[model samples]
Target: MGTVFLAHHLSTDPSALSPFALKVVDKSLSFAADADRRARWEISVLSRFRLHDPLHPFLPSLLGSSENADILCWAVPYCPGGDLNVLRHRQNDSVFSPSVIRFYLAEIILALQHLHGLGIVYRDLKPENILIQQSGHVTLTDFDLSRSLTPKKLDPDPLHVACSEPETDSDLSRTFTRFVCPRKKKNVNNQKGLRKAKSARVSPVSRRNPGSFYERSNSFVGTEEYVAPEVVRGDGHEFSVDWWALGVLCYEMLYGKTPFRGKNRKDTFKRILMMQPEFMGKQPNALTDLIGKLLEKDPTRRLGYRRGASEIKEHEFFRGLRWDLLTEVVRPPFLPSKDETELTEEVKKGGIDIRDYFDKLKAPSSPLWSPSLDEQRHNVSLTEF
Candidate 1:
């Protein structure tokens, strides 16, 4: 929806001094209206997360923002390790081991849980949107597609009760006291590798299912391959859609591809509505079983539909996981090296001005129309999709 630039912020206050990903959109563009709205919505969501005493570790913190007659801009902490998709591509088989997937998925679930508690539905949940922080932990990004809906009130259940106090050190430690690592299994079919393919992003579908649940969004949004079946059927969706996408993500991490991808978007949506996820192993393991439940076509039958993330957390696949000690893990699946974290001399002195870069783009006839020095050095450019 907007372009992202790697820029350095210089300030007298040490706390404000750091490199940030500056996302900017030219207000003069034809599509700027919708993009502007999405940007503001995303900022609002991040600001809401900050209201908590200690912000959710897996969520982004809005650093600053700016606006003018021609452009709008906002800054977020820069992730040096890129995103999960890039990290997965770097792996030998372009897939993660079960342990690595478990670690990342645990953090992601907590993030989603916090969001659900606040009535937010993270419609988009894919590897590209999962960024690895400098600390080697995962933080979700791209909240533009996220929607806020009122949660349904159900009969009293212990699993549905919300935590009264913030998670204290003792509370977290207690939760992890019985943690145990899962045993690894060897994949027999390693020779047949899957090719990297981009998922389709289609315009919102027009159909709507009025018979669907009350707290549901009828808007057809999300990447095609990761989209939920209810969304494809225009049957409305809520928090369960995120779980469905999570299943797609987990399957992709294990098998190197999405479960329902077909030759085209039509065929893809058809498969999503009709087919079951295929597994490589003959026997059903905890991980496969978890994916199967999460990928359930019926939103009501989905694993996280009723109790939200709590239902997913109770699955055998995540048994004995130290939910609270996730941040304490000294080593994660992957960490950015010293070289990746280093900034160029030019960036150290003073990064390029985002406003000036957009101004140059406005003047097509100017010499700056060609790739500028900053573009060559930092690869800064406008991203529209």
Candidate 2:
């Protein structure tokens, strides 16, 4: 829905840092109302984390925002090291080492744990959304797709909402069987992309505030590859979906690609429902076991479903972890070099004026870029970071 730009604030104070990423969304375009609400929601959510909190040290805090006129914009600390996706590409094999994965995943778990504590479910958890801070720590960006979901006893609906998608009993055993099978060999396209979506998933349109805290939403949203089976099946999902996505992210970090990705979205969704992740090469025992548990199709049986992140923290994979001192690790596996942090005069070099960009699209076309007439060609990314 918008573009991210490298920006800075002019300040006289030497201690006042200015460099940040500014995300601007134009609300005068199509789906204006829904887009406007999400923009406001993101600002509200980030403002809550603006204060320094040791528990949420890795999460981004909003610096400021402006909803003036037709544009909605906000500023967040810029990560000079770029995102995890970029860092992964820097590796010789486009994958992280076991030790590097351990350090990064440990910090991510803590960040997710803190989000769950605040009654928020982070729907988007992937390499792109995971930004690297200058301190060599990771900070999660983008909260537009996330919503507040309170923990409450799920009542049996007389309407039979729970029974709509009958739970598959034999699938659990089938999953275990597939786990031992040799993973399929990597194809040529795996080198360039971790996994790119061919099309955007259809999300429910809404003028209403994302349901109240006590309820659940059946909205089909989130990146196609990262979406959970529960979400794909359209059974009102809750906190467990995050755990499922966590499993996908873990698999990608270790293997350089998402476990269930296929030739297309249809095939990928089918794989998510019917197949299990196949580990290649020498498997990391604890880590592989942890991924299996997280990817359980039955949300109720998923590893972190009941007790949230605490259940995963106690798993054998994270044993001997020093959660408190994660921030103190001065020499993380990869740190942004001086050149990465150094600002050039052309930081905003190809940046578009968001408001004018939208205005020009609405005008009659000339030789320049214009909105596509073919319906299939137009797809919104819905990124409101």
Candidate 3:
């Protein structure tokens, strides 16, 4: 769960707004130990590219992030529109119309296009992690695990690449951290944070859950339910991890539950690594076939590896989608609304920048308002005094 801060107000009532949802990684968690700080810095570093990327439903446009940004630890646009995960859970899931799924797919494709063009691999892609804006746009968010592949490729020596799996222990950390040293160590020049986090062979999962462990306890990234097979088996991991996750998400969306789930972690990875996904109980054949291809154990066989997002969209399931028309399309399938007046008043108390996020978009082709690079660097200092 994340701290609920009001990021902005909806356009329906320009006078008021809704809350922004931002999840801060707990310092106690290995991933978030420095992830919050890293996310903002990464954006700042990539602001040049971010400024040029088109505003679309698939990516939640970053507003601003700060060290002590209240209500939410990380600032993002307020999206009262919720997401597919909430919609399916609260209401019900059914065969989405071609219009609905196609439109959403376009947004997803566009998002991937931008990220991939920049050579940024978003390793985590899931419904729960996505954001559907108040304006009915879908955005892929939670880029904390994203990495730049092009930069790493520049190293002339193969030594720069991660080493092969170790034989001493089943875990990879024990064998690697000694030499693998984090990528951020040189960038941030933060040897201190690096050393503390590196002092681990295996980080015990949080105490809240007795058996809790790293997302891919095998390698130390995403959650167990969504971790990629390559990561679990100690195969070299890369940006493609996100594509693998996208497959998992597509599977979960069509079915109400994850493709590979178990009572415990060991059993879970066993299913992911060995078992094949099946179309269970009255599911669409088209959806099932898509997932079967998606949940392939080998990353090379998975969707979006060689051919890219267009290829994934062109899969038989999306045969009818007009890729050209998708970029400009609007009006998603189901748009939920509460009492406009009540929501507006509630938003006034919801601490987000209502005008900046919701009303500020000038056109679909052009976003007139975004956090200026200067403002993003030097956060606003408010006074409650």
Candidate number with greatest lDDT: 1
Residue pairs of candidate 2 with colliding backbone atoms: none
Per-residue error (Å), model 3, residue 20: 5.3
Poorly placed runs, candidate 2 (over 4 Å) = 11-17, 51-55, 153-214, 346-385
Candidates by TM-score, descending order: 1, 2, 3
lDDT of each: 0.75, 0.68, 0.52
lDDT of 1 by residue, 1-385 (tens): 6777776645542222366787777787778899999999998998887787677788899888878787788888888888899899999789998899999999998888888777788999999999999999999999999999864443444433343323332232112111111233222222122221234223433233322122567677899899998787665678889999999999999989999999988889878878899998637999999999999988867897755676788899988887878988878879999877777554555545556666676676656333334335453322211
- Per residue, candidate 3 scores C-alpha lDDT tens digits across 108-181 of 75677557655666666777667666556676766666666543222344334342333231111112111232
> Of the candidates numbered 1 and 3, which has the greater lDDT value?
1
RMSD of 3: 13.9
Tens digits of lDDT, candidate 2, 1-385: 5556565543332222446777777777667788778878888889877553433677898878876777888888888888999999899889887678889988888777667656778899989999899988999988988998754453343432211112122111111110111122222111221122234233322112221113455667788788887676654667778899989988888889999888888788777777888989855699899889989877757897655666787788888877667777899988899877766544422234456555665677733332232122221121222
The residue ranges of model 3 lying beyond 4 angstroms of the native Cα positions read 7-14, 17-36, 45-49, 68-74, 93-99, 151-219, 282-284, 340-385
lDDT of 2: 0.68
